[model samples]
Target: MPEHAEAGPSRTRPRAPRRKVYPTETFIDGRGDTLAIRTFAEEDTDLAGITRLCDEELSEPYNVYTFRYFLEDWPHLTFFVFPSADDPEPIATIICKLDMHRERTMRGYIGMLSVDKAWRRRSIARKLVELAMSRMELAGANEIVLETEFDNGPSLALYEAMGFVREKRVHRFYSNGKDAFRLIRPLAQHPLLSMAALRERQDAEQRSMAKEGGDNRSAVPPEIAVLLAGPLAPPTAAHADAMAELASLTIEPLPKPRPPPSYIM
Candidate 1:
């Protein structure tokens, strides 16, 4: 049998096409300069500008690696708003990333957003956020989430106007010791509202009630304890129900008991 010819090097597989950037229409700032709003593009070198704007405006400090972590992985989700065609730096920018949250839901997280002071009140921030949300929704994100300073009225109002709700408050979330509000905008039925999440919430509430009961027992005064155990006290089942409600703090018991005297008057 003839010897087989030496095999040639294997051809490399073609890479998948890059995801398309989100589209935008023409927008002019208050100064009549046409603004460009779009995702980070291959030809763009705005990383330094983006970093500068964020550092100048945002309360949080991020190193270059943090910016790279998001931009390199999710360039399509990173958007910028330039005040004019000739301007090399963007006046506003929003950075975001999409991934599985809790291994259950597809969540989009907006990591940073900043707008130059000169560009304030021109609707630039809102427009950039809306653009990011639309792209995230199209990319199969079930919900988009972001955190802003709790007392940042302008940020809160802008997000709320766009249908985002305050999901929860994170205590001392910033390096400056300020609190933040985790806001969420659901493109579809949010995972937090699913049966599994609802069950988890219910169990948490029950545990909280149980803990409250233990606290109340320790806090009860001797005089009030006597009233709860007297002959006219509620029946056993009714008493349990009352205790449960009390533990939940749903209602206050009537006729507040006077404090027990330290000694006989």
Candidate 2:
């Protein structure tokens, strides 16, 4: 499913202000056209342009609510490319949001991306994505995720080139009954840190404790560890005998079957 939705109850604290001004960047494209990039501002009139770009290029039909969900909550996360410093109409735009996923980790979601056909092959999309990702990483996003049409080779290739991997395929995900591939890029987080050093330190501490006559029982029992290592193997002969003994002590054997009753004529 698309990441855009009603802000859930998991977000209880009030977020930062909605209309904070952000820095604007200017660059010259390959065609010698100067372009301006800036974060979406509440005062800007580029909403129509953004909607128009997506409506012109993408298949999904989005309403104003979808736009507001991403733009209003995370204005800084959305980037727009203008034709020049004075142009209010955006030629390209990318919308994104960051929120806690299942109350455990912060997840960043890219909801929409669109670029004008005239501006293709200029690497504008990549620049916008890189900007958004850097901001999200600074804001503590554990990972980023987005979905694109399964057959969109260009979209898939662009995302994969930026380190995203296909996580799964969702059937008939789009409004037009097109499949989508959910892609994910994991960022460096505490859970992914190497544990070898930690294990070695723990082993050394345990050895020191043993030398000092401290009781050092294994955290997990040997039998439980064996069971946890993998699927249980077939019961052994000794296990079968123990089970039989247990059954004999706890269960009563069935009585022999009695003959059927004769029916009276």
lDDT of 2 by residue, 122-177 (tens): 88888888888889988877788889999999999999999999999988888799
Tell me the TM-score of model 2. Answer: 0.64
Worst 10 residues of 1 by lDDT: 256-265
Q: What TM-score should be assigned to candidate 1?
A: 0.61
| Angstrom error at residue 75, model 1 | 0.6
Q: Please provide the root mean square deviation of candidate 1 (C-alpha atoms, Å).
A: 18.0
Candidate of highest lDDT: 2
Task: Kindly report which residue stretches of model 1 are placed more than 4 angstroms away from their true locations once superposed.
Answer: 1-25, 29-33, 42-44, 189-265
lDDT of 1 at 24: 47
